[model samples]
Target: MASHLYGNYFSTRSQRVLFTLEELEYPYEWHSKDFARGEHKALPYVSEHHPFGKVPAFQDDHVKLFESRAICRYLVARKPGHLTPPFAGTSSASLVQGARFEQAASVEQSYFEPPLEKLGFELIFKK
Candidate 1:
């Protein structure tokens, strides 16, 4: 199955998704947009793919996905058993496994990320 990633070098969120794809050995076409020119803010790219006109919009056979984190999750779910085991939706044991994964992910998002993100914004992006 072919997939496309729309992004540019400057977006850290885009890089995150790109890194995950590389780590998973998932082959995809990369479509670079001119961020300086605000090309991503235009139509079709924004309206058809990403509602927010964000960089790192992803499209595959099944769906078009926006948001860097969601794109990463999709890549993992699409090809499980490589880096991560498949989320078995039909079994209770697997459901518990999913819950635990969610818990850890929640901890990272709720606790670990906020301070780090703030620091990153102040130190890196807010120049």
Candidate 2:
């Protein structure tokens, strides 16, 4: 089954998912949503793609997903060993790596992204 992404190019969250897809070298179709025209809030986009009318919605085979972080995690889990360490093993080293990965991700989400997002919004959108 083919993978598909419905998102806007200007959306940072969409960029995150796009980066993950590129890093994994995953093949997928990109359906660009026209934010200017409120395409994301229309029709099947809101009803089928993303319930909240948000960008970066993804579909892989029968699985539909939203949230950039969730999409990245699903892509990583599907194609492991490139962007992440082996998470399947029950060994101590594997567990440590997994914990570290989660910690770093949490830090980025909680600490790094919020400030950057706020700054971007203030500088770009607010202007």
Give the per-residue lDDT of model 2 (tens digit) for 1-127: 7899999888999999999999999999999999989999999788998999998999999999999999999999899866875575889988898899899989999999999999999999888
lDDT of 1 by residue, 73-120 (tens): 888887885767557776999999889889998898789878998899
Worst 10 residues of 1 by lDDT: 81-90
Every model: Cα RMSD to truth: 2.4, 1.7
TM-score of each: 0.80, 0.88
Residue 43 CA displacement from its true place in model 1, Å? 1.3
Maximum-TM-score candidate: 2
* Whole-model Cα lDDT of every candidate shown, in order: 0.87, 0.92
